[model samples]
Target: MKESNYSSSMTGLELAREYYFQVGRPMLEAQFPEYLPKIAAGLVGDGSECLGFDDEISRDHDFGPSFCLWLTKDDYDAVGEEMQHAYASLPGEFLGFPARNTSARGDGRVGVLEIRQFYGRYIGAEQPPKSLKRWLYLPEDKLAAVTAGAVFEDSLGEFSRIRAALAEYYPEDVRIKKIAARAAGMAQSGQYNYGRCMCRGDTVAASLALNEFVRQAMSMLYLLNRRYAPYYKWMFRGLRDLPILPEVPPLLLRLVRENPLRAENAWKAEKIRNPYLNQADERVELIERICVGVIEELKRQSLTSRNDDFLEAHTYELMERIRDPELHMCHVLEG
Candidate 1:
């Protein structure tokens, strides 16, 4: 049960895809050739591997060679058990990688899966969400999971086609609503309450405010890029890939690492700040700078027309631009 130190050049997703191609596919072809066209195979869902962010350290637990074989309900009823047994019978190791340890039912990351159930586990629905509320309610991270990872093979085209449509950006109204909500959140947490909390000597509250600001700011960045934010564990890594606001992650890291209250302590030291406090002040400055950058992008995208550092105003402006009458009438900060 000890962790492995072996670091392969390929990512876990790559390893899984290789395993499927070199071994799983051939085994299936020999044993269940007729079933090939009815199944979709890939490495997707619930892991850093699925997002292609796995590193050497990621090979600790629940990390190894594996891929999913997704079948429609009709197909599952016919050959589900046989397919599972066949999948389990593959080599315990592949290309120098160790074999997967069997997980309890409903807990395994790989193997045969019903296509609807596979999607339902992430998106709360077996089918693609068609309603505005359903789309709005699903977490961005969950959406990211459903869409992340590569589908190595899909002879039936059912899975990939649905995935392609889901991968598209939200409707204009949905994007505007989300952007405005996140913008308002940033304004409340960073612009308004952060300073007030600092003035009250409530460093704890100030830290929470900083966290909220960072959280909302990150979401806003993903919305601007029209990309779903991955789970928080890989958010900064995901943020680095955004075409817009790519530099914000490092700035966010600094904010999270330094204490904002340190700036006041530095001012107290005969008005001569120490290097540590200087760094803290610089982080605070970067917060405002990030807001400006986001504002510029919002205006560039024609989502807003406001000209101020206040994010709430930009939120309102964006809300006004929403063409959907019903969405525009809801609370300006409503998601």
Candidate 2:
């Protein structure tokens, strides 16, 4: 039998979370049972931990014994201090792990935090949204981030509503705004800009055009799916995980990463003067197809209405559905 090594470089976010799940939760249940029903504990968002991208290298002063606790303002104020004290009292060491102070960044992990503060930092507000204004205010990645990681304990069920509010997805104008933005960018870079850049012998600029095309295409897809695009750096890595366009993600990546000079040759073969130019146009078509595929996936999952104008006005309708406060939450689409 082989002995497995502990993932030493694991995320402080996850470590703080697992600590609570194994040690903190049980300890709290035994000593402070009353608080259990009023709050929730879990992990989600872009913190290296949430995405499972954290490592031993991630353990800096900022890393500490951290987990999220959710409570309404009243409940939070009522028991906040007591809960904080109790949390502090929990054995400082667990499974050979040491707890870190939450204030500023310390040598250890950033300890527990309230859900409101956690979400607010990412999106500038706390609690799930029930209005268009709140919905519109949410940054795309933050919504996706909060919903990305796992929930270890959700006693109060507050996280679900936040997740649910975002679950319905992006709003109508939001989609158009992002799509129009990305489309205009796509037209500028792939449709119009890349060609001109290549013609000028600015291969560097040509490459930038490819990058822009890839970005706009991705924003277009995420908008269509009513999901937020993750951080720009991780967009492609994350985009590959989307089931709707798995087949073409690699292809898109290939086009984006292709040599600008050689790509120019392919475009001449395409008789389009711009190798990357034709590639960009193809992306526009691909974006529409991917959009339609996602809409069909929604239908398959029963996530949308049949009479909702899917074919004629798919993106807008999806955005509209997501915008409706009454319909903020949605179940994951079934295969």
Candidate 3:
């Protein structure tokens, strides 16, 4: 039979939603009406598609119409295996797309997932971390993954409830702690080390320092906006959407692109009028400008009151703002 004509523009999430409603949902209603309300279905976890960042290139693998059906442990024990079988029996081809070509490690991305097991896999716990220390330690990208994408229907409320709690973002103390760490990292890497590395003619080290600065700065922006930065692969892609530091991305791009390493011959020649030195100077100034913007935001958010241009100075002040005694006492860089 000829394929249907749905636009190729349909994203993975959209395709999953449609596939669930048109195929999965009806299958559940017909064969397991008693279990319908207990299932929480959605496309989430471990995919660019979940974050709505998938494109044509993303279709090369693990890219097709598939959604997760989360069931409570009790319900899963009773019918999980049978439900999985039924789900597997559904149409392989949906809309205009081929069946998912799941890799060896991609088995659990979709299909019947036990609620606690699914959450545990992504978050290290079935429920949101209750302790400030726990919250401080959980990986930000993992948190982003657990909460990304949509929960189509969660009448059981167990899965959605935990997800909603996690989606609220980090506790204020945890955020402050993390922000303080980023501030310290930005200072040590970009403000203090980038120039020094350039002076020593260690262009590779300078580039590494600048890279660390960009990563920390991007993470700080996400913390400031109360969003969890995704995995490193998508960090910059995610940054463009942040409400804070909208201008910082361009500066960061220039910091990486305008490296002294790119002009190595000038440095090797040891010329008095090295254009590469000028480029290095320009990067230092850019680093300060970025730091000033971050400091201003820190002051505006009441994270720090210090007026210092060096971010390390503000790091101490921000760390002191953490109300939790245990978290406050941990290394300022611990977060």
Instruction: Estimate every model's Cα lDDT from 0 to 1.
Output: 0.80, 0.58, 0.87
Report per-prediction Cα RMSD to one decimal: 3.6, 7.5, 2.8
Candidate 1 lDDT by residue in tens digits, 1-335 = 23344425767887888889988999889998999987899988888888888876666667788899999989988998899999988887776677664444425578998887888787866357787666777888988988999898898988887788779867778888899999899988887777666656577887898889998999999999999999987887888788897778788888788756566575444343433223235555777878888999988898777789878888767877878777778786677
Clashing pairs in 3: none
| Candidate 1 Cα outliers beyond 4 Å, as residue runs | 1-7, 101-106, 267-280
lDDT: worst 10-residue window of model 2: 326-335
Model 2 scores a TM of 0.67
| Highest TM-score scorer | 3
Tens-digit lDDT track of model 3 for 43-84? 889889999999887777787879999999999999999999
Global lDDT for candidate 3? 0.87
Instruction: Write down the lDDT that model 1 would get.
Output: 0.80
Candidate 2 Cα lDDT to native: 0.58
- TM-scores across all candidates? 0.91, 0.67, 0.94
